[model samples]
Target: MTAGFALSPTALGDGFRIESFTEVGSTNQVALERAGQGDPGKIWLVTGHQTGGRGRRGRPWDGRPGNLAATLLLRPKVELATAASLGFVAALGLRDALQAVMPSRSVSIVPDGGDLRGGGRFALKWPNDVLADGAKVSGILLETAQGGRDGLAVAIGIGVNVVDHPRDTPYPATDLSAMGAGCSASDLFFALSDAFVDNLRLWQDGRGMSAVRDKWLQGATGLGSQIAVDLGGRIVRGVFETIDSDCHLVVRGQDGEETRIAAGDVHFGAVASARNFKAEAR
Candidate 1:
């Protein structure tokens, strides 16, 4: 455990263990290396400061001091696709954790079709981003490798801004403290670990993905609104429809066509329009 921020075992619940560090290159990298060395699953690698963290699409994730950077190692008996759904599980868990720590009055529960622009409302962005007041507060990444006793190991990496966040980014970012949530890195981790356990039980190795999808949609951002998905080489502008059973993003294009995006960067509101214009210019 790191100095001044120790994890509470009671709050972590059962079937989960944690390895804490004051600093690490990346919690995901460390977890993967431990898995390769035959470490059993259900253990979390956490750090108050991470030096070489990463986000989706190989983007650099800056783990500023006093923020939370953690990864959970799991050895599931399911296939790769099924295991990939853990990202959704992680996102939901993060939402629950944020809600748990923040003051009840600080959180506004937004309905499925309700306005998300209201401040202090925590919502999930497609694939794996948690938004607070339309600004990103956390990100989740899942990495897999052939190891562990079950021959498959998954490292679910999660980063939450507790005291500070990077200002210059593609999307607006904020931290819990800035939102008036009085909590520390350790406080958030305890809530998150317990939330992940509950969500994992609900996930049930993807057999219960439908249930997870339904709950995730309740607090999803930009649903039923115009958005653009950046697919690396191209951008697709369409209505932000619901996600399919496989958890793939379902977008209804302006041409009356529906496109299922397996993986892409999603943009909303003015950002979506800007991305579409840039793509058209190219």
Candidate 2:
């Protein structure tokens, strides 16, 4: 359980329910069905493990039971664009919660790159991916209802590799176990819940997103760094510059042009010189 929301019957709020199971197709899928049924906010689906986990752009991010394979269904008053920032807010909460249990593990933040920005100097790779040390440590996938006004009932799916990195994926991945991280899903969940609830209110007020935007830049792992975006079959390369609050990613090419990419697969480089000049980083 996070600081505010709980995973049991006692803490279930208004229409929110926590579904815990041994395995399932995906929490996001399950939550989507529940959301359509008019499920109230904070309905969480937790499995012992996710046999088939996924990230944005349909990339597979595998998850074992004990890991955090949770998704919340909510019909928020916030706009569709602002809903994307929820991932950053959740990441910050998870990072902070992890620190409380393992204070000596060198949990550092580096804005220019090479560390986690504790105070939130990290950059956001649009759609959903958090960069720490130029490598992806956490990723988020937000799907919306897609109608105007009542348009975006959302399922903010977050996947944090708590135990190990992915040897199956082309992109470099790391897990908590590899990073020597040890925290319960319950504790992390509670922390995440509290973080979301706190930020959700900010989002409701519209001020939440502005704060989210600034924190994202601070915790940003890829701002001012070069990278590429692969959408459909076309590939665009440039120095990854900024992400607007609406979650639009702006990539600046060497030709001194800025490209606004709405959706694509993002790649980051390990070497600055090699990466900062229009190279694919996956």
lDDT (CA) per prediction = 0.83, 0.60
Candidate 2 regions exceeding 4 Å error are: 1-17, 99-125, 131-134, 146-152, 205-207, 270-282
Model 2 lDDT-worst window of ten? 114-123
Best by lDDT: 1
Which tens-of-lDDT digit does each residue in 1-282 have in candidate 2? 222325533234434567676677788888777767666656777654677778766878777646667787767676655665666566655554444544433244432233332333223445556543334566677777753434457787776666555676555556555655566566666656655565555455355667766665665555666666777666677787777766568899999898898777765454333434234334
Q: What's the true lDDT of residue 268 in model 2? A: 49
Q: What lDDT is reached at residue 134 by model 2?
A: 38
Candidate 1 per-residue lDDT, tens place, 1-282, comes to: 334544446435566778899999999999999999998888999998999999987989999988999999999989998999999999999999899998433354332223453224788888888888677789899999998345899999999999999987755778999999889998898888878878988898888999999989986877787777778878888898889999999999878899999898877766566634554423
Clashes of each: 0, 23
